[model samples]
Target: MSGLIGRLRGRGRPPFAALAAGLGLAALSLSACGGGDAPPANVVATGSAPSYYPADYAQVINASKGEGGTLTIYSNTDQENWAPIFHDFQKKYPWVKKISANNLDSDEVFQRVLSEQATSGSPADLLVSNAAQAWAEFAAKPNALMAYKSPELAKLPKFAQLLPNVYAMSVDPLSAVYNKTLIDQQPDTLQGLADLVAKDQGKYRDKITTRDVKGSFGFTVSHAFTSARPGSWAALQKILPLARPETSSGTQLEKITSGEYVAGFFISAAPAYPVAAKSGGLLKITFLKDGTVVLPRGVGIAAKAPHPATSKLFADFLMSQEGQRAVAEGGLTSYRGDVETRKDRHTYQELVSKVGESNVIFARYAEVPGAEVNAFVSRWNGLLGH
Candidate 1:
């Protein structure tokens, strides 16, 4: 997909000569439409600052224009989810020639930044990830991130400000998914699911799925969900015995889709929502009625950012109304309440409305005590009979 987008940027062409004939008409259409050589006339360019913008916001834009180069980012999300954002950002800030957005694991995003900066310095200007533990660990290092407080910060929810530097890029709720055809009694909560399975362990034994809880994402969501309430561990005792643990959300969703697994809990909705959208009634998803864990993907500028001014501009742009709407268009849940609601996209406001404000558990950016984490993982493993 990144390669496809690169081709769209006119940086390169498709490798196969055989494809030229088929692509010729599309090329003609692109040329006819000016091929995005400039932003549309209606676009309020970044130079035209809004009233809410900081007095010095114009200086940042001018500085970025002076930099006049690619704004490199290391992110945990796929390029498909970033394409719309990059397109919209470029439209607003035309001087930014390109955005090199690389998709990597949440932990790897920090790893690359740390390892590179240790040597010749990283080219990455921005970093985005939802792995809470990795984030806490990274921020513990000296000069781990740039401590620029965005003017848009005041507009965001307090929890969005994960640290002095890091902030939430998107708020994604963990969802429970099932093969509706295979399970007639769909459960809305973990406790309910446990009760349903307990009625007939023969049918559900080894059929339920959840995260492995060793990896960063799995641990963050699992720990948040369980620690949110008193009875969660009790519910897990019933469910985990019959569950198979997987490392990736995509795998869990696939198994559920194929009926290899009857249901999966603690699955990231970033991937699940899109799959459920096109499942044609085979898949169904619901937030846990007891407690829904909302994981915030953190975004921060690198301390040694190659394009500091451009990174700052991009960070502020992400918190703007237009940028939030574009984020929703990219299939990410926007947290800002001002954005208009759509049936296809979920938002933090909608999650609160459905699950209630009190039941929404946010995975915090603070580090968990090492002893507590070790004990939790040990108990979790024991539940799996490991």
Candidate 2:
């Protein structure tokens, strides 16, 4: 995995004027408009994303004229830490300008990308994001993304695959999260939490938590449910009344930490617990037995990027030691087996071992629209009733 990113929803649209020179913000704006009834075109469509990088793509892109230029980045990387990565990239491609679509969530990022696609504005050349499903279409589906490969990708693990265009950069485990001290004892897996609720219904009733069936956290939960217990989501319907899923993962985490409820879910496996524990927060989690449930981050270049050369350079930079280290500094985990940072490699290994390598659908959202997630969310909303 190249860029196993974090979660956010409808959050990534910045000011149109500030987006980039020459392009209007019409494409970048997030509108809850009607999506195409049919899922996006597949790879066979006129312009499918690159599943296999051409041998000389890097040579050509790196050798291009606009060697020193700035390219817009639609991402969720925190400013405080990402500065170093940008700075390092600048060192490599001093001529290229690097701008981040900060504070924007995954949905907003996708919306902006789509908007750009429609307006014929050069979509952000580099998309450093975590929403695998959103961009899957561009890589394998028709006319979604252009095909181009970078030599850097070859260094990553085979499991970190998200089509050829996208990279599985980082990793996170969907553990059985809980606020510390809330639950008397920490169970070993998600089933433990359910059992806790079943045995001590009074304690967790209405106070328990999970993500709304909207974001990736809940999405991960759904995948896990489907795999472990085919009909578990339906079973969860019985317990929905007790679950207080919030609109956002950040919110879900905050509620559990404040002791408004005892136990809830959180990403990141055992190694990350210390970070949460540093705050002296009441939180903990465990891995399931059967399959490893992990969340890998991925990203790819826009098929119609304005700065083609810059895009390749940027992606290459990301795959480099400097870029990888920069991302690691953001306190995230990557699927790259040989991440540049020493500490992150250890942290990543710890999480995967505990939670298990998660069930990841590379670039499925943008490609296979209704396969697993759409039906799941629809049923979930019916059960949750908003």
Candidate 3:
């Protein structure tokens, strides 16, 4: 839910770089390598389709080939984070000529679709975001999202399906990120961090940062953390006063890396882990011991998609085994059990195993009761002294 995390210049090897090298850009020059089994220029290779695919899946693929082979998406994710998955999608469906993903605020993903659809018709074939409440609101709107049940739907956890059509793009955990040079003692839980700050009040004051709960992502993560453990409020009360509330994950990570801020909590792991992997021992992160909140980024096709057939193909691809692997490679946490765990790259399966199922707090798709949301935000602002 890092709504404002734009192009990142991480020091590590670009995600999926190896895969891209091995695959080469053969799709662009398919005719150069003559293969007897190759599908026609416009159609996908039916023989290569997964066995789990629907019987009529070939029809969907062929239909997409005739429908202009382009897709437009409204999402909160940066293109760099999506490059691996996009690369794989294009490689699989060589006919797809363009993929336009506009990065926006989580809530804006829905707003843009709704606004455009009501007027000149939204160009969005798909929409992706982590704003749970906004997704709930959009679902309430008639014909907002197409009800396309993917073949991979049954393979995913029930919770992965946010609504009839919306699905979790990635299941990411909220974690605490700290600068190794700034703090001698590393705490694994929010309460421990609070205790550490209280021990040296003067040194820690204004040195901790977190998401501002006024925004959707910030509010969702914080609310889930607090709700999962009521006693966490005691810890937050001590921490928030001495902390600065940031509107973006990128800024929090940047300031922490530069030592301007010593630590940050309820930070998104999707972006944090990849950056930490290449921080040269400067940045470190820990899943909260008391309760780790798992936020699932949601994706779905638009009801009035300009490229519905292509959108359907892309949606199915996202939930497939290969797609999930690309998702993890691209730095987003994959939830599929089959996706193997790698250094710095996390999967929801590993998170559940690490934290114990009880401590893995899932941020559900439903809107938090309006009255409850208002109360939570009010108290959160109070603790921040805002």
Off by over 4 Å in 3: 1-48
Q: TM-score for each prediction?
A: 0.89, 0.72, 0.87
Candidate 2: tens digits of C-alpha lDDT, residues 254-362: 5666888666553434233444556565465455553335555666777777777777666766665446665565555555555543543333555555545453322
C-alpha lDDT score of every prediction, in listed order:
0.76, 0.52, 0.76
Clashing pairs in 1: none
Stretches of candidate 2 exceeding 4 Å from the true structure: 1-65, 138-143, 215-217, 228-241, 266-278, 285-292, 340-347, 356-375, 378-386
lDDT of 3 by residue, 153-211 (tens): 87888877987788988988988899999997999888899899989888988899988
Better of 1 and 3 by TM-score: 1
In candidate 1, what are the lDDT values of residues 255-361, reduced to their tens digit? 89998999999888878888898999899989998999998888999898889999998898787777777677777889988877688666898888888999899
Cα TM-score of candidate 3 = 0.87
Q: Tell me how far the alpha carbon of residue 198 in candidate 2 is from the true structure, in angstroms, after superposition.
A: 1.4
